[model samples]
Target chain A: MSTEISIQRSVKPLGKDELAALVARDIAPGSFVNLGIGQPTLVSNYLTEEQNITLHTENGMLGMGPEAVGEQIDGDLINAGKIPVTELPGASYFHHADSFAIMRGGHLDICVLGAFQVSATGDLANWHTGAPDAIPAVGGAMDLATGAKDVFVMMTLLTRDGTSKLVEACTYPLTGVGCVTRVYTDKAVFLIGPDGVTVRETFGITLEELQQLVPVPLKATSAVGV
Target chain B: MLQFIDTVGEAVAGIRDGSTVMIGGFGNAGQPFELIDALLDSGATDLTVVNNNAGQGDQGLALLIKEGRVRKMICSFPRQSDSWHFDEKYRAGKIELELVPQGNLAERIRAAGAGIGGFFTPTGYGTMLAEGKETRFLDGKWQVFETPIHADVALIKALTADRKGNLVYRKTARNFGPIMAAAAKHTIVQVSEIVPTGALDPENIVTPGIYVNSIVRVAGTPAERAA
Candidate 1:
């Protein structure tokens, strides 16, 4: 039998700046987006205002703008995390029931979420780690993950200890199963396909170099660099 | 008429122990203190309280925790306080604690009010949250089905109410009061002021009188009263 050749054996690494720029480039204009807490929240500030993207918050606010500046902060207009925020010109307020209706009813076009781990099959685990020291809390990340039309993950490729976050399976509690369509990381952009992790681009590193970064086995198909 | 009561004690006369109560608030913003006081005076025990957060210290729900009346608490979190009796009891396995995600807790209450049996959401999958939960595949993704939550007694706060029980809330204090009003079997509201039936504008009434079973007019500083 002929030996199978692995294409991902040679891939490159990407820097953080390149990852953020790639994320910004991919966000289409006029999309309804929900940014998760922490780093995902930063995506709102970087979004180009000319794109006409509307932000929906689960905490009963819609048409959200970037975090407020000195005079624009409204105590009443806040995000799901209870952080003070600014309202867009056409912002509207309603009972939170309607806000969740929009979420569960599949009205959101895109949802970017921060994750603790992403499995090879695109399963997401971001809430609790089940560690004794971990806080027992799972926020709206669950609803946003399952409800949004497209779920995109934003996280570092590896842990502080150099453990690869993109793994064969998640060890932490999962937020959604097979919900992740794309992943944006400090390393490189990857699309989770049925075949395996497909590299869209490696910021500065080569395909072979990037393959070395992940401890898990990766199948590099012809789709690499696409 | 059974409408007006001077003290919270008079309003909570028939309430007994082992009651499942829904306490309104998002954090400590809109808790119902008058009813809590009345429950304290009634010496009710074995309470199952559903609220956004446990009161800070001896302030809101903390009072009940201090009194040793709560047998179980279903809330999002307990903030601003340390050494709470309920926390101690929870740690010692003396009480039951069901912690829910803040937004999910809110949706469960709202769903009960809307008369829906259950709704499917993809919030908690492949985690401990998925354990004992039914999941379905929607749009090529997994979603967990969460059931609605209801309560026997709902305690709420209102900025102003008419004699007929039309209610209005001031600001963020409006958090879960309106929804709890519909989800509870018996809803009792503590109002700062009570006016004539027609005094409140139709547009200003946040909660119509139909869902309200009783009204207690509290006389004190806004901070002295809960909610």
Candidate 2:
């Protein structure tokens, strides 16, 4: 007896900012979120206050706001990166221990982190390159990855060399396994599925063309023209 | 009854060379200096040290690195301070370093204490960190594989402790102490004071005695270790 196989078509990609907005829409009101350092940190500026989201920093502040103007900056009140920041009303200070408890105890609803490579299986590898000269720091990315209820990866879709950051499997040392739930990229957003990476939507490109852009083999199916 | 040793040198007597040790504190805020000094005097080499930060400029764990005792270090940021030893040795390829993101380091230790083998994360995707590891997709995004971390001994500090070994830390000193206590096979705590067992309230205890194997009370402040 012969067995039949089926393939699915790919989806389009979204711009970096557009993907950020998409992630913002997914966050529920009153949710506790951790915006990781670098690009993921930019998501804080776009979160609508109506959502009532409470931002947390590993450095011991909660109910954090985006970076403030020079005059408004408080030298003592800063985030984990030591960047000057503003605190929203109802904010309180706690021991750094409590701040980490909120993270390690899995109390956070969402954690958005920048990425180096996202695999088809949703593996993360953002810290330590094994480079002899590199400083070798993992920061707080590891905790946020494993502790958050949901994780969203924010990064460019491809490297400068045109290589896709999303792959069939990660080749670098892992930070967490199967912790990511969604991916938002400059070109497109892909959902890592048991069947493989399934494209949810795209920004300016088409499905057929996206297949050519991605390094991993696309599961071909019907046309998903957008 | 809990016996308080006269000096830190007598407290760390059983620790041998090539032992895996977890040190407490974030940056240099709450390190166990007395215990570190004793470990140094013991001349234990080939040590695998785990901590949040390596301590500023050869003052804390840097002393170990300088003595050529440390074979490897697993931490979040090793050079967050002005430590010449880390830069000089790391540059010379003398020390093996595994850098864990701060949060992940905490979780990995906690996971080991909680009896979990491995957990998932999405922190390192698309960077050099994703070069060689297993990955999986959950919900819709990418997450990487991060294994648990554990140690053979934990050298920790506490603001206060009762004779029963219930610990309390002041401010940032509590950084990795509680979790380190849980992750290590044997935890030796150095504290400023050791009060009666019932003196510490259950609510205020940071690390329960169940996780601590021994307690040593320092006579002087962490700064007086040299004297």
Candidate 3:
């Protein structure tokens, strides 16, 4: 397991399916959740029907399944990301206001989102990068991060250029402040709290190795290989 | 009272220049394409358009902007892979954009229909979006005040509507239609089917006739309507 996790800088990153499976392993049963647009959308595919966890898309569909296959794609069955997906049993359609009301009203138990960077203090910066040409893509992220009972981010620990996403402060325009609760990265899982970001689990590396690799110094805890 | 209008041109004729209009859709799913075409032909200019996206293709609201009809846009998802029109015009500073958090955008529009002045939301509390807006920590959370977005006119699409203007939306494509209908002064709905009064099941009606102003019939079967 340790050798398998030794990622070369030039090697391809872990596919979203493996990351989704990792995120899905910890979700409690009977929780209503919303998966964010990108990598977070894959989390729904890993959940079992037995979990009884309901999925909501902000564009007005609840009880969605994985993305629809080739012929199964329906133009009208798009999720919030505008990607086609299948619906589970007892699926329902709603108006935009009511759907967002469910989001902002804090009915979701958890929201899995993809982030550009997360601060040590749980602030999130996903809407815009620190670039002039970057369009502000503040879709439903602000609402999801702040409104959900818990916010879990799924992303790589490092950017493609090897910059650590776990930082002292995020430079990108914030989607919300102190809203993130947990982070599921390709390398490890972090719990963001008032004290700061802490490692809950790592893929196969020790806390010392991860600390050396990242930009920020780690408050090394009993990092388990979960 | 029957509110089904004669044609798309007739329904869009009341739209004046500089009117703030809410067009319903998440992308093109529930877009009122025909009404937009008519609005384009009518030469209405300086229009403030509000919706979820900044339009996708060369036609529709994007076309309205390409023709320089739109002065401003209030939307949540302002960029898409194919949203070149918005990207170009916005970069050129020719068109203005007010990016809203999607939930806040929906709630503001909902607030208008519900007759609420404004509300506080935890979203955008400490972000750049909260700058200049009144904010406070309430119940152990930071919140920002969002005002209602009341549009002068609303152009929406529905799956089926009765002559009395009661609307029933399709599966997931029903994004902003009902709420936009409620938040605007005049709501013109384009539905694939127009049934007689009391024909649609009352239990299934999403937007009651009281909120809707008029309905336009689009040529498509009920099955195709949901497609």
Q: Quote the chain B TM-score of every prediction.
A: 0.91, 0.92, 0.96
Give residue B75's lDDT in candidate 2 (0 to 100).
Answer: 80
In candidate 1, what are the lDDT values of residues A117-210, reduced to their tens digit? Answer: 9888888888777786443556566777777888889888889998889888888877777878888886667888777778775545656877
Clashing pairs in 3: none
Question: By the TM-score metric, which is better: model 1 or model 2?
Answer: 1
- For each of the candidates, what fraction of the native contacts does it recover? 0.25, 0.31, 0.83
Per-residue CA lDDT of model 3 for B1-227, tens digit only, reads: 33678799988998999999999888877878888999999889999999998888786888988888999999998888989898899998999999998989999999999999999888888888889999878878878999999999999988888877899887777889888988999999888888888899998899999888888888974334334
Q: Calculate DockQ per candidate and list them.
A: 0.20, 0.16, 0.63
Query: Candidate 2: global Cα-lDDT?
Result: 0.74
How well does candidate 2 score on lDDT at residue A177? 78
What's the best-to-worst order under TM-score?
3, 1, 2
Residue ranges of candidate 1 with Cα displaced over 4 Å: A1-25, A65-77, A133-135, A215-226, B1-14, B32-43, B55-58, B76-87, B101-104, B114-125, B134-145, B158-160, B168-173, B190-206, B216-227
Better of 1 and 3 by DockQ: 3
Compare the candidates by lDDT and give the number of the best one: 3
Residue A149 in candidate 2, Cα distance off native in Å: 4.4
TM-score of each: 0.80, 0.64, 0.93
Model 1 is docked with a DockQ of 0.20
lDDT of each: 0.73, 0.74, 0.84
Candidate 3: deviation at residue B53, Å? 0.8
* TM-score comparison, 1 vs 3, better candidate: 3
